[model samples]
Target: MDDNLKKLIPFALKYKPNIIWNVVFNVLYALFSSLGFVMIIPVMNVLFGEEEKVTKLPTYNGIWELKTYLNDTLYYYVNYLTEQKGAAYALYLIISIIIIIFLLKNLFGFLGLQHLMKLKTGVLRDFREKMYAKIVDLPVSYYSEKRKGDVMARILGDVNEVQNSFFAVLELIVKEPLTIIITLGIMFSISWKLTLFVFIFIPISGLIISKIGKSLKSQSARAQQENGYMISVVEETLTGLKVVKGYNAETYFKNLFTASVNRLYILTNKIGKKHNLASPMSEFLGIATIAVLLIYGGTLVLQDGSLSGGAFIGYIGMAYNILTPAKAISKASYQVKNGSAAAERVFEIIETPNVIRDTEKSIAINSFNDKIQLKNITFSYDGEQNVLKNFSLDIPKGKTVALVGQSGSGKSTIANLLMRFYDVENGTITLNGTNIKDIQLFALREQLGLVTQDSIMFNGSIADNVRIGKLNATDEDVIAALKIANAYEFVQHLPDGINTNIGDGGGKLSGGQKQRISIARAVLKNPPIMVLDEATSALDTESERLVQDALEKMMQNRTSVVIAHRLSTIQKADVIVVMNRGEIAEQGTHDELLAKNGTYAKLVSLQSFES
Candidate 1:
């Protein structure tokens, strides 16, 4: 509880101005409500013929003297009206005062709610936006170990719960205390004895409420984690629905989803039961307090006639007011427990160290020159084993290099490292004599283009998809890029041409057409460097040939790094690097490698039979 409270203080402090306004309105509302209860005294005295004539009104001489003086002045005015216009006019004045207090109470209540909502929603928006930015800015290695849906759930669902439930607790922070204080003050003025009794039971109720909420934090955390798992299931199913159907794994996935949801159901029920206990238990305690107050106050009145009927009734009213805020405080205790679990999850992502960040004084390069050098580079996805060890490579300003290797042999790792997707653990990778780490990532990436085997496309028009590579590219430039990538012919034949809307992930397009569009996108980028990672491996022969032609044209006069499984594809490469178990086993042109009769030779022989 202390830890959760500590976490909330920072978020609360972030929106202090809104919190201050909310607190101001809440305090004012509570004060007005209690004052309305106190006003009943003078009006009732006039009605019952127990009115006292006063030459001088009440006065105060110590701490809280101003508050006491105000209460006295209010009572005196009511007395004056009672004397001037009889009991009926005083009754009307009391009714009018009650109406005014009620109005002010509701008005301030609305203002408090408005400010609370503003702060709640504002924090929610900012938190989500910052989380999203962090997610985008984070190194790719982070996502390799994390579920996409889990991240999504944290950003959307869990964050929302924190905003709603956490701020709901905060609303009580101001309202409940103010209500308890004002009501206690009024009750004490009426009869200090009864107010003291009320205070005694409050701690006992608080202790019980706190005990009930003890397990709520762990339960809420489990619920949020299960929610992430459920979302992951949904995301996986959507992304791989075709594979699921093709492999006849629908029932298996359905059962998995059902089990996850069932666990979520059980956890939700647990959380709900814990949350629901707050209202009823608090209500029961309140009833017990009220019953005790009645017995004690009744004994006092019956024994000595010390407590007046009006005063006793008003005191009970104040006690009743205490119940609402007390219940709220208890409920907020539960809510804060729940929100604390979510806040921890949310803050974890927001506070994750950005392992990849630009140097403070890094300068941006306008163009690539000289050569890209990888000198004695070593890297590892996990710290235990190196994926690339003592690796060295150099590509001149305007040449093509193809890296071919078996699975997990550091083919794709080269592409990843070259793009600075993950920084190397040891040694230097430099472009034009400048270390890649020392350059601004955006500027460095802007100078390079990547096209992977799995072509990615959003749901948008062809023109929009192409323009994504370079936002400022003109329509003419897009069309020219499409032509260069051999995509314009099919695109022009579509019913809407460039305006045709591709479905999600380009589901509307054939695999071959998607590859063409991807090539078109790369061509549109016109970056000085291009990285092609088995870009044509997924295509049919005809499509591969067309895309290869487009790629060749795009590669012209550019520093290109190619990863290919087909040895025939890199037959014309200026350099071919064949990796075996994180180290280069063979290097040279296709013929030179085949003549070596080594790993590259065996790979070419195996692929020749498969092709």
Candidate 2:
């Protein structure tokens, strides 16, 4: 009845057939397990002559009298066998029946576990798929507000915790309750008064065990939260190992990581110590209850002569049988509490709202026409400070427009808004006079090509990375795009040409080579509009020259919005706009801007001074 448990209900419902089969097998297992304990009665009767002799066969009875009828039948056969063969023959028969009952019990238990495996693994598979889909659909702004490793922890570590702790006890939750119920039923049939005493002990044992694990959920939550921080530190350390080594800050990061893990270790020890207590505590309680039963049941048999020794001994056997499930159920209580903490964290990712999604009834666009326009737009990354205020720009068809700005001048933010990576606070970016917010998100993005300063690459072949621009592009198309980006010459020299493998994030290639391959990708997309965000700023002189040439070739005959820090790259742009403090300071031809001798001229002058 926990809400965390209910999170799995939708996934669990898909495997209802597995659930039904599992329950059926568990019922059989519980029935036979208790019946095997009942077999002790006939064996004891054979060994000790405690049952009365029966000379004639028992009469058949209706369902109401079936218990009495079966008891008489078992006794009649035992007495017959003892007389005709020997007491040893009857004892052999009882022992054989006990073996058969135990065999069936184990077989049923195995079948129950087999079906449960399907349910557990299936639910985990579906839930993990849903988790991944949600992660992929989340907007870029979501990651800006979250740590990569914290999100990774929810997907990997926390989901596994839900498996080990939450689904781990599902078997106990299913089988143990039925085992206890059936065992208690057999005990009550033998002696209802003694069964009543058992009912009192179990609930009391459960209550005591419950108290120790009450704080486990909160402790477990703290441990998982700390785990996210630890993973984040490791991830950041790996990602910026060059910077860390360059700055000689290894000890600082190491100490920071050590502190995080220390907190996690302390929390882990607390949860472990608390969870370990449930097993022994339940056992001690089970034994204590048995000691009471031993005194009380012996009085009924020896002093009062009201109960038979065989039945009383069988009652004791049944009472001890309850111990296994009782221990498991109590331990599972702790596990459920522990796993619920993990479940909450995983669900947090699954339930996060995706704000940057397509609007309802949004239409799709297949082609760009006229121009792309940003009209009276205001924007902010954080609500309090505006990155761009009342900004407007028009990128006309087949004309290149370059935005020149220093850092924090909102040049890249313009590119992001055009791409709709983040929606504006107050503005409309229109394509062919249609508001872009009214266009399908995928359609809008599909029509524009982007090449950023960082050339993001996957660990795959050169051809595979190029194909991302156009998934259906052939080898010939890829080669042509690479040539246009000035990358085909190098590609041809590799051992496998376009098929040569690139290491993680193109670590195998130089920055210039990586950027060219990225340009090749955008060239392959061949959209109506191109947005190049400082594509040549991070290169050496020779690399920048080559990449700059590739950018010029790719931008030909395409509407381009170029954000550049380097004035050299935008000298031939059809219109040059210099931005400062989120507004345009100047806009004209390169020669026209120099004549004005304002912000654009000043920017060019600074670069000349540096050179």
Which regions of candidate 1 deviate over 4 angstroms?
1-16, 55-80, 594-598, 609-611
Best by lDDT: 2
TM-score of each: 0.94, 0.96
Q: Per-residue CA lDDT of candidate 2, range 1-611, in tens?
A: 57987777778879999889988999999999999988899889777788768778878879887777888889999999999999999999989999999999999999988988888888778878999999998888788889888888888888877876655566676788889998998899888878888999988997898788889999989999999999999999988888999999999999999999999999999999988888899989999999999899899989988888899989999999999999888888888887899999998888888877887879998898799889988999999889898999888999999999889999999989898888888989999999888999899989999999798999999999999999999999999999988889899999899999988888888888898899899999999899999888767788788878888887889999999998999998999988888888889989998989788888889889321
- Highest-TM-score candidate: 2
lDDT accuracy of residue 19 in candidate 1: 90
**Regions of candidate 2 where Cα sits further than 4 Å from its true position:** 165-169, 609-611
lDDT of 1 by residue, 1-611 (tens): 44644565665677889999998999998899888777776666666665555536877777668766765676677678777886688788788988898899999999999988888878777777878999999999989999999999999988887776777666666788888898897798779999888888899999999888888989999999999999999999999999999999999999989999999999999889988889999989988999999999887767867887667777877888888889988888788887788888888888899888897977799899899999998999989889999999999889999999988998999999988899989999999899999999999998899988788999999999999898999889999999998889899999999989999999999988888888889888989999999888878888778878888877888899999987667777889999988898878987787788888878878877322
Estimate the Cα RMSD of every predicted model relative to the unseen true structure.
2.4, 1.8
How high is the lDDT of residue 131 in model 2? 94
For candidate 2, the lDDT comes to: 0.88
| Residue 9 displacement (Å), model 2 | 0.5
